[model samples]
Target chain A: MLEAAGTPQEIEGRSLWRDARIRLFRNKAAVGSMIILGIITLMAIFAPMLSPFEYDQIDWGYIQEGPNWENGHIFGTDGNGRDLFIRILYGARVSLAVGLLATSVSLVIGVTYGAVAGYFGGKIDTIMMRFVDVLYSLPFMFFVIMLMVVFGRNIFLIFIALGAVEWLTMARIVRGQTLSIRRREFIEAAHATGVSNFKIIFRHVIPNVLGPVIVYMTLTIPQVILTESFLSFLGLGVQEPLTSWGVLISEGAKVIEASTWMLIYPATFLALTLFCFNFIGDGLRDALDPKDR
Target chain B: MNAIGKKKAVPILSVRDLKVHFTLSGTGLFGKERKLKAVDGINFDLFPGETLGIVGESGCGKSTLGRAILQLIPPTDGQVIWLGRDIVGAPHSAMQPLRRDLQIIFQDPLASLNPRMTIGEIIAEPLVTHKADLGKEEIKARVKRMMARVGLLPQMINRYPHEFSGGQCQRIGIARAMILEPKLIICDEPVSALDVSIQAQIVNLLQELQREFDLSLIFISHDLSIVRHICHRILVLYLGNVMELADRDSIYAAPKHPYTKALISAVPIPDPEIERNKERIVLTGDLPSPTNPPSGCVFRTRCPFAKDVCATDIPTVDTINDHHQVACHFHERM
Candidate 1:
């Protein structure tokens, strides 16, 4: 009644989504992480124009040099005389691209699959969810490495591989959400109004469940990035000139005694990026939780 | 829309022996299913432009019957014949057009509306669904008009349901139901969730709208006074069985069955003197569980005048008067 009796202009209503956005922006940690993520993404995009040298540009003289700003090699040179700073920037592109693309793939597949399962309960839900449970029981990383071995280290395939494995959790999350949402009276009201199941699923059901899906998405992106790095460490990720943070870190690990900058720089950036994503995800979970409202 | 006003004698909805039984999840290993007969073999007819109130206690299955008649919940057995078409077991796809005509207003107003949609969108949803060719302007105009009719401000159409009070949200729910111009709108305890003061407002609004739209309503409620005020005919149910079905005056004045007598007696008289003098028939035992209802008669376990015959012999509904019916073997003596 407090809101109902308010003046018209004062009750200028905000939707659940807009309200969640306002709350998310209020959190300092989430906002700070977002800014760092933005900067890193921008650096990844403008790596070629900003860097003094190409990712693989070899200079035999300055090999294994410490980070010195004098020769325009801000992060010094790698063991193979390539500019480390530009390689790290290039690594950001590969890592972030893999993260986003893999997550996108999972989002599309998982949302559709879960919506179908949850909307049509009983036998269909049991079968669909049992399929997910079976997939969950499989050794995930082992399968990803197997796919890479079978497909010959294709970077695009890595996106598909990681996405394929990652969607099990997403499906489970979306399905659980959909199961609860499908029973809501609004859904019944929609059903009673002769709205087709398809419309009900995509328009009414999905929009409501998006809060959890979105929070889960933020969490999944960082996980996907870390998984890509692990694959690269195992020599199964982006090969050769196509460098990721994982590849850089593994290479750095080999000659850490000689030049610690390679290991230190990539690892620091990777850790910071993951930490920021986690913080933002936590903030989103808190903000979007219906219980909090 | 086709049969809105064509016939006067024929009932808009004829539900014959309708039953809705929910099977509980199986126990331990063998998983023997147990059936809870929520609405067990109930029959009723709803004519156009008349309000039929179903009054019962908490576990009387009144809500289940409403949903079963609307086909919102699938019935375990029997016919829900709407305009000669038996829609008891019709598939969801086939029920699409029929859904437009047979709409429902839920008990919880806010929960029954999509939290994400604006009030305007929620009201316009039925129109958009049933009349797909309606122009955006036309839909908006109709929504604004409906909102105005429901005593809600048309200017606040953009506000969400959360911003609205309980009564306002019920107004929104009513608007949604009335927008489609349905032949029948089942009010499933629409005012039960509102404040007592607000309940009268909603009830009066519904009465006004019913006249304005020539709408048939199956108003389900447990409040006897509210039912007596608005309902033309009241059906008294006890544990899924109709004890009495009569016009408001007849049911209130000379209730035949023991259960109806108890229910009507419980309604408090406004005058203190009459209220003090009134005889209240307070039943002793708790309502028998639906899963294990007493043999022959559902209300026998709680009926004060329960004899040996009441337990073994099922009482058939006997027509007591022109418009009064009672399903009690010992009604004449009572």
Candidate 2:
């Protein structure tokens, strides 16, 4: 309409993703959490290597000592003679892995399963959703204990079990999302173009539903970590020599009166990490919508 | 890419008694089920390069008819004869080849486009799906070309649909529909969602594209004024039934059916003198629920001069002159 419409160089194109990312960075709490998470993750990886005492190494010199610099045990030794700092670092690796990998496993399974069920409505949707409902009714911890009993306490199996259990909710969320998305005009437009149903589900349906799926995924990671911790408390998680925050916390909780630092250190790390994830989740939910989701 | 051959004798699209009925199941245990006849037995023939306007009220099934013809919503019965082949019950594989020649432009311009996809990907989707052998460069070139043709700047091809205004989004929709160079495009109220100023631009763009590509269009809308611009012939539908079908000028000047007359009268003239003096025949009462539509004639309940006979026997379409058909019992007397 106007000849002086902004020149190509003047008119910069901004994608929704770039805008969301910019907004996400602008949130002070989310940015602070991200920086803290990055620092913690880096410390978790490198801090253990720099420590003089091995995570499992027992020093008969400083047994049940309070946090004192004379011993070079900054976080102090536990009821055992091992350094608390190195063990917490080791715990960080296990907990973060369980959180991320388990959540990824669930995301893959849930997104595909839900998208297929919702796209192919009618009998297929009913049967698939009913199956999900059946899974939902199962006792989560009881079956998880059973898997541990049968599989001999493999940490990988814990991931699979937690992921499998966690995906029921993800599948339900994705299915509900897909149900609404399939009726959207874009999906019909895809059909009008003669795109195969298979292509439609993967390309058109899944990508649009990913916003909610991603928000749900951020929240699910913390839940998965907490579950792993609970399992460890029950003595079914990572075995001896390989410790997690859960293992550290359970060990520390028993002798809290004699040594409160052991409980406080792991508990602080756990709470801070979980809060970071929750805050990040809230920021993403806001940023993704940008129009007040 | 389209090779235009004007076949005056044979129609490009022949929708013969096409009906798309939906059965709504009961909500509770004792709730009664009912049939909603959205598009009940509509007949029309669209010749090559001609524009057929379908104007009706909100629930008169204008959209259902457009989707039915494109097989977007599969028809319940009757034939959608395209190029001498009935596509009503055609399988997906069989329809894929035919889809290249048939396309539709949706009403909500922004909603019709995938938010995740760029304008280039959205417009190139049909080409990528139908033309399997096209290289990436070739497809991109074709997409850009189509974009330019639809009055969109080629530089904006990579932008998302949300980045564009309603008029620009409709242009993107048109580029997508026209990229395959389809023979017939069912524009399902394509401009209804745009601003009034933008509506004229979109309509003009559509007309320009139609002329250049030799495209036949079945333009459907609830607004009769918008349909009057580009349509060669116009059809009047009341409650999924065609009340009248005639040339655009005849329907506007001397409408035979009362429903058509009311619709025509509702269209405001631009001049203040003519608009103020025009006798507007405003129909009372809302469109009846399609589940329990009137038995004999769908329009009889709403008709101003409805004789007792209008409610007993259904009025079949009567041919008044060359291709001018009216479905009213008192058309001759009126």
Candidate 3:
């Protein structure tokens, strides 16, 4: 079938992947979100270098100070006199880290579990899905609380807990996607070639199902970030010294009357980060979608 | 009928009493487990470098038989000897090396090629997976060569599958299958999804490639005319059982089995005058489900010529000539 498409030399004129990327870029909202996301990611990475005030540094003199542009406290100080701008910048590091890291962990576990269950089918699929259903029935807050109680409130534990819970939805999505993709001719063709089951699942099967997986992963990041923020708001996340956006929001909400700036700064940053991630995920959902092509 | 002259050379692939049964839980309230015999005791031999066509109506176990031979689906009981190796029950790990020799072309070309992957990547995947020793440049060169062989533009290697038409997609599918130089290719209705003109093109291409590669083909299709054009030998299956097996000419000119005869008569000839005059032998009743097939002969329920004896015992292949075999009680009278 490859021969009829014309020669490799002829294929050099234009590539499909490039064309897809071009079409994706033309989606102004997606592209714009991607750029903003890229900038935010860079800022998060260079938080230490960019922030003059250490995340833990406190100044009693500048307590509850509003955005003072000349003094270089661009977003002003929190109730603890910590630079809100610097804290939020550093807070991005933790929020993005937890979101990305947890999502990655979920993706690996989810895609593998889903592919195997969907590909093998029959009894294996039923059993795996039933397990997922059991997990799904458990309340999200209860599950997280149970994990925190069992594993303690370390950063790693938070990542593990969020990832473990998030994978259920991802597994369901991946399994559904795999069910449809496994029925495709290429998979059968791969089977006919005597390709190893492992290779078939990982190489051929996973790549085809990556579209939905990627879209789900994008959406999943926000969910994880929100969950982490909620946990931190309830005083169970990030501990005292190492603060996340959730920690900042939690602290800010306590001093809303005396220092509205504290509440507004962290809340705006949190909302913006969530909006950016959602926009990026939505863009990717459309871009990577085979139906759109 | 000179059976002695051809008896010495063993067929490249032989399937003996192949049965692929799926245990389906009853949909009713009871949820009783019932064995659905998808491929029921089918037997055939594929000669080296011969295109053995399996022609049957939909849900007649033709595709199931193809998959069973490849060990894509585990057979309940059977011996699929490919060059003396029983592949029916062979473990997937043990069957890995044998995969390079056996490949398949699927019916839906569009669905067969991965949409996300470029044509080049899709074709190179098998080579990369199996032949790991080959370097990047060598793989690219081989992919380009294989692409050329399938009549695809080599430059279009970077193009995704959706960019191509149905014929183009089928070509890509053919390229992927033939890239590794597999000896036995199971073409599961490869051209049935294509237009009439494209079907002829694909069939011709398959025939040319088969001769060039000296490959044996298990061509599965419901299109009798297309099967007649490509296959050297034909196997007629009905309700997961072999109804007839013969050389193409013998099957077309003189089909002994009533089922085979009915199937052939149903094919509409291109010529209007002959097509109008031709008597169509439409079989009575729907196809019996493989879950609970009729006793004795599976075709007895629908066979117009069936008698009491026909429903009592399963008909074995009765040799009509050196290469022609039919599974019908009245073959002698026919």
Give me the candidate number with maximum lDDT.
2
Q: Point to the candidate with the largest TM-score.
A: 2
Residue range A45-150, candidate 1, lDDT tens digits: 9999987798989988899898988888899889898999999999999999999999999999999999889989899999999999898888977888678768
What is the lDDT, from 0 to 100, of the residue B170 in candidate 2? Answer: 92
Candidate 1 pairs with clashing backbones: none
Better of 1 and 3 by DockQ: 3
Using DockQ as the yardstick, the better of models 2 and 3 is 2
For model 3 the local lDDT of residue A110 reads 92
Kindly indicate the candidate among 1 and 2 with the higher lDDT: 2
Q: Can you rank all candidates by lDDT, best first?
A: 2, 1, 3
What is the C-alpha DockQ of each candidate? 0.48, 0.55, 0.50
Docking verdict class for candidate 3? medium
Model 3 C-alpha lDDT per residue in residues A1-293, reported as the tens digit of each score: 44345432445324445665776787888778778888888987888787678878997788879889887788998767888887888788889899999999999999899989998898999999999999889897887778788887889888988898888888888888889888777887777776677888887788878877887888889889988998999988887778888999898888888778888877887887788778777777777764764
**Ten-residue stretch with the least lDDT total in model 3 chain B:** B1-10
DockQ sort, best first: 2, 3, 1
User: How well is each residue in B212-286 modelled by candidate 2, as lDDT tens digits?
Assistant: 988999999877888888888899998899999998888888999999989889888899999999999999899
Give the poorly placed runs of model 2, Cα more than 4 Å off: A1-12, B1-8
lDDT of 3 at A159: 92
Question: What TM value does model 2 have?
Answer: 0.97
Report the poorest 10 consecutive residues by lDDT, candidate 3 chain A: A6-15
